[model samples]
Target: MKIHNFSSGPSILPKEVLQKASEAVVNFNNSGLSLIEISHRDPAFVEVLNAARSLTLELLDLKDKGYSVLFLQGGASMEFVRIATNLLNKKAGYINTGNWANNAQMEASFIGEVQEIASSKDRNYSYIPKSIHIPQDLDYVHITSNNTIYGTQYSEFPTVDVPLVCDMSSDLFSRVLDFSKFDLIYACAQKNAGTSGVNLVVIKNDILGKIEREIPNIMNYSKHIEKESMYNTPAVFSVYVSYLTLNWIKDKGGIAAMERRNRAKAHLMYSEIDRNSLFYGTAQQQDRSIMNAVFYLNEPRLTTLFDDWCIKNSIYGIKGHRTVGGYRASMYNALPIESVQHLVGVMQHFEESI
Candidate 1:
């Protein structure tokens, strides 16, 4: 039986992208060398990097907007440090939405002052904080566009006078947004983009050079930009697979089409959680993430039964994070609506049987 993958990270990817990537691993572009075996400086790999960067800008509609795209080593977790090292000259404001948001603030605090401008921690991060007061004195404001574990997303981004930086690791290419609103956006490729090991960072050219701290060459965004994301040997396989996925997104009509598809899946998943008497959603309805639909079984004792049912039906990766124990149906871009329908069918069957 086929598995319905709902893994939060290192999640589902387009089948076509996978097929092409697998082929390249053995023999890239009909050449005898595997993609992983090729030198990072090889002209073919360089073209892939350049094309991927250009495609990212094109899809975000950010071309010629004084923005530069870099697929750098390390994950978004690494970016937390890089972002602070390069940008945090003075204090920065961070909106603590979930675990990742809090971690980002903690990382930045070690570099300089960090103010928790807004937070929903009082409610266990079940909802997004609506009332936010960003201080004008802040060097920049940081936010996680979507909380994968909490299943909450920013329906509308906070308006800030200071430069805006967003860690959109989980929901970067899964929705359509006004990309120009952010001065910097970083995303790990493991979720909607590709496998782990690479992070995509889009920086506005003007955001650099203001900090007085001596940023080491490796941690400096400006240095990475100067080398075009090749300051060090890049994650070759991850970047290539991500390039293929980007091509898939463009061919499928870009971000607008992705938003519509994701909305449909979320609606179906959340609708089941609401309508079914056996279950209820964990996150606030208004702030529910289109990428991750988190819910809980009303009869906690039936957890094992539900897990068994899901596994029997070839449904996997529906378990929630430890912080919020229950279930989380991650409906990413590559997750077909049919999979959501299948999971709903399982929910209905389990409810009826009980």
Candidate 2:
């Protein structure tokens, strides 16, 4: 049976990207050395780094716009700390949408004062907070673009006077957006971009060197940019995979094309969740994520039955987060619409049988 991967992180990649990356793993650029075994400083690897950076800026249309792209080691979680260290001078503001947003806020508190400008946690993070007020005193405002665990996302990012920072980990390349609005944007490569072990950080050059607190070279974004994202040894394999994926996105007509495909997949999945009597969505209809759709079986007793049916049909990783305790079908940029159609077929058939 063909597997339909719905795993959230280290999630789906284009089949072509996987094929190309696998070939490189065995013999990179037709050289006998495996991509993982090559020296980071070797011209071959350096070219990969340069191309990755160049392509990233090109796709975002941020070329020559005073923004620098860096593929640094450590997942988006590491950025929770590095962002505060480099940017937070006296205070920062965060919009708390879900688990990841809450974690980002908590981590920034360790560095300085953190004001939760607005939050949807009062309603179990089922909706996006609106009419957010960003104080002028804040050094920057931070937000997680999408909540994978809760299946909520910001439909439109808030307008703020302060420097805006976004963690676009889950939905980085899945849609079109005004990429220039945010002063700093960071994402883990495990989702739509590529696999694990690396994070992409795009920073505007002017935001640094303002903080009074001393930052270690390792945690400093300025230092990383200064070294051209090679301040130390980088995540070789992960970055290479990310480069391939970026190429795939560009060839597929950039983020606009991705948005159309992703919307279709989301509509397919959410339509089933709504029409089928067996299940209902968790997040508010307006706030539901196109990337990860969280829903639950109406009849809790039928949970095991549905799980068994999905497994028998080769559907995997549809289990919801423990916090939500239901089902989540993550529809990423590369998840073909057919997989969603398959899941919907299972849902409809199971509903009728039950």
Cα lDDT tens digits for candidate 1, 151-228: 999999999988899999999988989999999999999888888989999999999999999988999989989999
**Between which residue pairs do clashes occur in model 1?**
none
Question: Over 4 Å off in model 1, which ranges?
Answer: none
Compose the digit string of candidate 2's lDDT tens values, residues 292-336.
Answer: 999999889999899999999999899999877999999998889
lDDT of each: 0.93, 0.92
Runs with alpha carbons beyond 4 Å of true place in candidate 2: none
Compared with the true structure, the alpha-carbon lDDT of candidate 2 equals 0.92
For each candidate, give its TM-score against the true structure.
0.99, 0.99
Range of the 10 consecutive residues with the lowest summed lDDT in candidate 1: 126-135
